[model samples]
Target: MDFQLSEQHEMLRKAIREFAEKEIAPLVEKMEETGEFPLEIRQKMGAVGLCGLVTSPEYGGNGMGFLARAIGIEEVSRVCAGLGIALQVHHMCCWPLETWGTEEQKKKYLPRLASGETFGVCSITEPSGGSDPMGMQTEARLEGDYWIVNGRKCFATNSHVSDIMIIVAKTGTDPKGRPAFSAFIVEPDFEGFSLGREEKKMGFKGASSGELVFNDCKVPKENLLGKEGEGLKIALATVNRVGRPGMASIGVGICYASLEEASKFAKERVLGGKPIANLQAIQFMLADMFALAEAARILNYRANWMMDQGMNCDTEMTLAKYVATENAFQCARLACEIHGGYSCISEYAVQRFLRDAWVAIPSGGTSQIAKIVLGRHVTKNF
Candidate 1:
């Protein structure tokens, strides 16, 4: 198997890396401190086609493959994780529509989303149900030509600023008396749709997280994302295919940044009348970090290639997300150790990288959940 990136992919990666360093790196500290999403930067990202890397060219996107998307995400994340997450949310919201929406639905939504004229958020987790989306309590009852939705969703990313939301709601009753769920595209201005309080998160502070309250919100029948009783299945399948790669790329970016910072510091810091780089212990730690980062990059890109080939890569994707994120967290922690007192300071980026690294283990799915998924695949159990 060839592990080298194609020339086109390399060009795209370098372009995005340059763009990220020029535009995103400068403002990240301010955005983090103020907890504000930089709309200007987001718009710039759209102009550069970073916001729609996986979308079709007919819809004003670049029509790139998943590998290109992964590269774009990794480069952007290396500079600013919060900005990277905002783009990830945008891509995730657009993906389900592209995969399952009707032609009319695509015509209506894809262009706007692709051009970044309209931003989107996905609402699946709720106050009561997070990892287990099948346990969602949100319900959408048919009323004439509309569906009346009533429920509350918490920990929703990009909820406050998004123009559209892909909402999951129960639509039917199963034989077992469980609620059958469906997905819908709801406008932020829909009646009875309101934004709840914003969550002050531990990291990725510039990316907004908040609650979405839908109380008797009436959505047209045409807004349904897919067929009834398919919401949970669709969500699961889409996340497995799209979400894991996005997250894995973030881990790669974080690990790269952490190791780069640590190496630079180690080479510069003097101890016992010599540069720390001369110390065997420092060299070993940096070597380990470099090895882990390279491994993560390989796994992440391999999973992206598997997705492009239309393989059933659930196990591989989960493994990539799990191992890459754990490696990233360890690298960040080690970078902090290398930085010593300077790492803990707000002015230094290591502290923020460490904080952001913590979110990766739980975002796409927890490490524990990934283990269970791999176990089921290996055992072939129900």
Candidate 2:
């Protein structure tokens, strides 16, 4: 298999890096201060085609596919992970729509999503749990031309900022005595659908995370995604296919940022009339950071490739997410040690990177969840 990135990929990476450094960097300070993502930046991302990467051009997207998306997320995340995750969750809305929505549904929503006229969300987590679909308390029942939705979604990224969203809820009981879930398209303006309190997080401050309350929310019958009893399947596929890999790429970006900052500080910081780059201890830390970043990047790249190839890469992506997120935290801590007390200063990006890294570990799925997945995969396959 070829390991080299294509010319298009190289050009795309360079262009995105330039865009992030110039367009997204300056506003990061305001976002960090206010804990709010700028609509201005989101619109800019739409204009530049980041919002269209995973969608088809026939539906107003560039259709750059999955690897391109990973590259985009990695670059943007290298600058600001909060923005990266916001966009990543936004991207989550596209995949399921493209994969399952009817042509009419696609025509109605994809253009708005592609143009950033509407921010999209996949609201799957709830107060009960995130990884368990059957445990969700959200319920939807069809009545005449519409469905009534009731329950609450918590920890939903892009919660307050979203215009369009996909929500999963228990619709009925299956023959096996298990809860049957269904996916539906929900709009914020719909009656009985209201925003709950916004969360102030320790990291990833630029994006919004909060609760989505559904109290007999009325949803049109046409908005049912795929079919009844398909919500669990759709939710799992979206998380495994898009969510984990996207978060893993963010972790890769954090690794890159940590390594870059640590290396720079080690070179510039002076001690005993010499640069700390000459110190053995500093050198070892830098070396470990380098190794972690490289390994994490490779895992992300490989998983992205497998996904683009239409291979069953759930296990691979899960592994990638675990490694990259854990390594990201390690890299950030090492960078912090290199920065000494200055690391805690808000002026330094290292603290932000450290916080972002910590958040990434649990964002896609926690390390314990990943271990369980890996255990199941190995036991079945081997």
Candidate 3:
């Protein structure tokens, strides 16, 4: 198997990394201080085709597929994981609209989404719980030409800033009396729909994560994303196929950041009249960090490659997400240790890396959920 990245991929990586260092790095301090998502920066990323990587060429996208998407996210994340995850979740909204949207819907929304004319979100979580879809309290009822939706969604990414949001709401009951759900596209002009409290997260400070409130919201029937009762299927596919891989990419980026910072500090910092790089303990710690970073890269890249090839890789992607995110947290801690007292300071990037690493753990799916998926897959097939 080939281990090296293609020329094109390498070029894309370098370009994104350079862009992050030059363009995004300058804004990190301000963004973190205020906890704001940089809409202008997102638009710039769209101008460069980063926002439209997986979108079709017919809609002005580059059609670069998941590997390119992962690479872009990873490179950006290496400099600033908040922006990396924000970009990743931004693609989450685009994925479903492209894969499941009707021609009319795609025509109307994909172009704008691709151009970053407005941001998008897939709102699924509720106060009830996200992992358990059946427990969701959000419900919608069919009216004349519109559906009246009433619910509250919390911990939704881009809730306050998104212009286009696809929301999942219970529409009916199944044969067993379980709630049947459907997905709908909610526009900014939708009546009775408004942004709720914006959550101040511990990490990813610049990336918006908050609540969406829909009270007697009027949504036209045409806004239904797929066939009725298909919301669960679409939500599952989108989260597994698109969200998890993007999250894995974020983890890989954080891993890279950890190793890079640790290595740089070890080489430069002097201790006992010599550089810390000469110490066996420091060397072993750096070696471990390096290994974890490499492993994260391999797992995340391979999972994204499988997605690009149109292979069924949910389990593979789950494993990648679980391992990469967990290792990223661990690696960030190690990097902080290598940095000594300075790592705890907000001025150092290592502290930020550690914060971002913790946030990634449960973003796509919890590491516990990932293991359950793997366990089920092994038991069912083996």
Where model 1 places Cα greater than 4 Å from the true spot, the runs are 175-177
Candidate 2 off by > 4 Å? none
Candidate 3, residues 1-382, lDDT tens digits: the string is: 8878889889899888888898899989987899998878878888877889989989867888898998999988888888888788878889898988999998898888888777789878898888888888899999999999999999888777788899899999888887899999999689989889999989988988998899999999999999889998888888898888888999999998999999999999999999999999999999998899889889888988989888989988998899899989999999999999999889889999999999999998789889999999999999
Cα lDDT tens digits, model 1, 27-92, are 898888898877777678888788788789877777787888888989988888777777777888
TM-score of 3: 0.98
- Over the stretch 1-382, how does candidate 2's per-residue lDDT look in tens digits? 8889999989999999999999999988999999987887777899888999999999999998888988999999999999999999998998899899999999999988988776789989998889776799999999999899999999999998889899999999999989999999998998889999899999999799999999999999999999899999999999999999999999999999999999999999999999999999999999999999999989988999999899989999999999999999999999999999999899999999999999999997899999999999899989
TM-score of 1: 0.97
Clashes of each: 0, 0, 0
Point to the candidate with the largest TM-score: 2
Model 2: lDDT of residue 338: 97
Q: Of the pair 1 and 2, which is ahead by lDDT? A: 2
